[model samples]
Target chain A: MNESAPNPGDRIPPDELIDALFDGELSPRARREVLGAVRHDARAGADLERTARVLAALRAPPEAPDLTDRILHSADHRRRFVPGRLRRMTKLARAGVVVLALVVMLGVAAGRRAWPEATTLADEQTPLADVNEAFRDDAAAGVGAIRSSVHQVRMSFQAISTADPCVARLEIEAAPPHARMLTAGFVTNPFGIEDERADAPASIRCGAPRIGAGPTIWVGSNPLDPARPAAPDDTP
Target chain B: MLRSEEHKLIREAARGDQEAAASIIRHHQQSLYAYMLRMSGRPDVAEDIVQEAFVRVLTNLDRFDFRYRFSTWLFTIARRLYLNAIAKHRPAYDTDMVGSWKSSAASPEAPVEADEQQEARRDTLQAALLTLPPDQREVVILFHQHDWPIALIARHLDMPEGTVKSHLHRGRKRLRTHIEVAPSSGDALAESLA
Candidate 1:
């Protein structure tokens, strides 16, 4: 027996060769050779029988109880309503988040109103030129009342004059019933006014009139001529 | 089931057609149950895995990949569920119990001796299978029982084809030995009793 020559029995492992033969992996010639070898070898033949028996037994289908109704019932319940319910829950969660955000924003806005520092900062940021123009417009419209509530107007006046030499005077007195207020104010020339009057409380007077109170009056001098008294017809 | 027909049923099932889902379940339930039964060695666990696997598959039918066989997907889901179940509760390989369960439902027309022999062979085969490691058992069951080709088993088991052959070879050899030894041992016990 030459060591270099392939012995038919030693060419493959018995188990592998048997599996390959059964799996049809071997060519017809190799299969005939393996089959012949198994027929002659008792152990190989028994291995083949064992493999066949196991395969036969395993291949025999066990009786599987019908599970269609049970599975369908579970799937139906999940498909019909669980996903819809989850979607609804997701929508409700989104709505809740939106409502919560709105509440937070409203709360912050209300909190900003309650904080004097925030109110002052906001008022300081307002252009004095815009405020003067707004006052002039309100005065011209024969409505002394500023568009904003009275408290905001007071803070606006205090913030404006305290930060700049643009002196504005606003006065309010009782008006007819049902009207909130009658406001009269004037912007004075910064160049004509003496520097000392810039600090004078009388030059930038603002009345603390309650909102929605009885109608109040506002009177002011001509902005172009600080010395001229406000005409009686200017009072609304 | 034909692949085209299976795909059609899957499409309809994905759209929540209960009839289509039932068709799919009926086609697959038996083979899947048998696979689970062999893997877990418990009919109850097998039944639970089958029902749960079908429910999960039908519910997630949209996610199924069409390139693979539906049976592959179903078996994969069932295999995972079985692994999880076994992790929670280890299954027992009770030959007497399994034999009785199978034999009780044996074909009424078959002769009693033939049925007994068939039941004994099945019992011995199952007991021998349980003795092998999980990987070898799975490879053997997929190859021999389900008639899956070695390449498909490789893909399913996520291993090289050579490795699958190695497992199959080893598993078959062990099964042969256990099955061969079982009857002789029984014979020796009977001789002693006589």
Candidate 2:
């Protein structure tokens, strides 16, 4: 076969032909041709032998009983849940996203109600900063005189503009007198200015020299009312 | 080609028959498990991967394309699962095949010294197989161990026939080199090649 090697004319490379021999792709006649050549040629013989031994050495371990059982058990587990559980999980995820979106929307609405945009006080010429200082001074003076009776005061700030140097007013209301050092706190608008109006009841008895210490001071019951009626001598 | 009986079992298993499913698992589990064990070099991981592969195969049985061999499709699914496991960076299953080989050498059942010697030789061959690149290792394994034709391997791996041939040739050459330089009694394995 090697002596009269009919050059099949580049149709089949020797390496490819030999590889096909191992793969059993060649016909019986071709198989005999390659097997005979491999037997006679030293290099070709080594190639076939090496391939065979390496293949032999890679023997797989025998299958165990437990491994088969585990596989069957796992298949059973998937049969129980794969389709149904996937659809259910997808539905739960969509519901969760909708709930999160609604919570965010409600949060924005509640924030707007709690802190409205600023509104101007009667005297627009006084900067809100100066009004804040005056309110602080009044509270400080009243703090000593009313310390025995007044326990806590709620100060609300209303701003007329969102930017700095905007107009605003601080109205102070005191809770019934308590033991601690006034347990002081302040309320500021979203603009960070400490000013706004809130109605105090006459029963609570709020008193400061600048803010009227009378029943008419608490006449208007609506906390949301915009009318901040000034006193007889202090009318703006 | 699956015999008529095996084909019938496959059809029954696909139709939610539990007993047929068990029979199907019994038929294919050995070769599948062995292939995974040799590929990953970890018995524990091989077991896990084989189980997961079967789960996927059974759950999607309706999608099985009948033109191909069942083992080919099964191994293809198993290969993909193995690759995904590697991609996820799951911890390597301990390389305890060698450790077990050591303990098995002293087993009371193997009372003959030749049995111990054969175990040692088998352990060396296994170690060499594990050291080959995974691609080369798998081709050599499917070709040499499973007797899969090169064409079938190309189909299973979704690669060109030329590429599969290249891998097989390079893999055999490398395995020869690996076995030659292996740590234990290299002469014994080298003689096998000769």
Candidate 3:
């Protein structure tokens, strides 16, 4: 047969024909032509023989039973599990949102409850530069006492609610009354004329002393109806 | 009748029918596992893919269309699950099909060896198989290992015959030369995988 002319017995080189053969992708006539070549041509026969050996090695036995079970189980796990998964995901998302909202709410509550702790501009300019430090000291030393010598003695203060000044009249828990020159004032040392006025209770009863010790922390059953009823005063 | 039977069983299983679900499982598991083993070359990984496929099928039986053959639908499900598994754990997969992927991929205990002769042939074939893209690989495994024809592959893949032929052509071309060499020598594997 002529080398260039087509022959029923001549097979195309493998590189040229393998793609068409595997899928029968070639035109029917061309496939017939090529297949004729592959079967009859000695070179093509050699090529196919070599190729079949490779396919043979791939013929490993079926996979293990356990692996087969595992695949089915995995597929089953995916199929059977959806509702529970959706329910779980939804629950987790809701729980997360709830936790986030709760955190925000807690932050707002704390902000409002601790309002008094916010230091005013005047306090910033004054000695109580560290307001939190002062409140902490006050809590530990004693409530409402300005000086308790509880080691590092300190004071704390907030605005006196009313513009008009008021007195603090609580029974002093005197650690030692002998050396106790307890001068209770509003720390208003610049205005010297009313040191004693500042020392007295701004809202005292008619005949109550200027400054004396009594149990300010109300303890008795009728502490309000004191041991003796005092007359009223128009100090307001 | 087969479709209706599978449909009935699937319907029952969706309604929490364990026996029916297991019946579905028992029917398709082996074939699905074998296909995955060839497609992925990791019996253990293929095992996981099969299970995941069935699980998805059962969970979504309500969405299953009865017009198609149940086995066809099952293979589609299996194919999707396998693809998903490939995606989820990407880096470790041997793209070139070297690194003992076929054997190590299974139980991690499948006996492997240094025998250049036996293992070399297997490695050469695997490496060539991996060269084709994933779709081509799917078609090849379904066609050769399972002996499913082009029409069935087309139905399961939802692709046209021409496209399936193209993939198979491309896949076979990629593999044909490598297979021809026999890999009796180590250098052949080195060159093929490389």
Candidate number that wins on TM-score, 2 or 3? 2
User: Could you tell me which residue pairs clash in candidate 2?
Assistant: A118-A159, A151-A177, A151-A178, A156-A195, A156-A196, A157-A194, A157-A195, A157-A196, A158-A195, A158-A196
Encode model 1's per-residue lDDT on B1-194: one tens digit a residue: 78999999898778666777889999999999989878766677788999999999988999999999999999989988888876776634333435434544567898887676655555666677887898999998898889999899898889999999899888877887776678764333223223
Q: What lDDT score goes with residue B34 in model 3?
A: 70
Per-model clash counts, in order, read 9, 10, 18
lDDT string for model 3 (A31-99, tens) is 666667777677666555555444444445454464434534554555543454565576699999999
CAPRI quality of model 3: incorrect
- Top candidate by DockQ: 1
**Higher-ranked by lDDT: 1 or 3:** 1
The C-alpha TM-scores of every prediction are: 0.58, 0.52, 0.47
User: Candidate 2 on A15-81: residue-level lDDT in tens?
Assistant: 7676566665677777766666677666667666665665666654444335556666777777743
Docking class of 1: acceptable
Q: What 10-residue stretch in candidate 1 chain A is worst by lDDT?
A: A171-180
Superposed by TM-score, candidate 1 places the C-alpha of residue B59 at a distance from the truth, in angstroms, of 0.6
Report chain A TM-scores, every model. 0.30, 0.25, 0.25
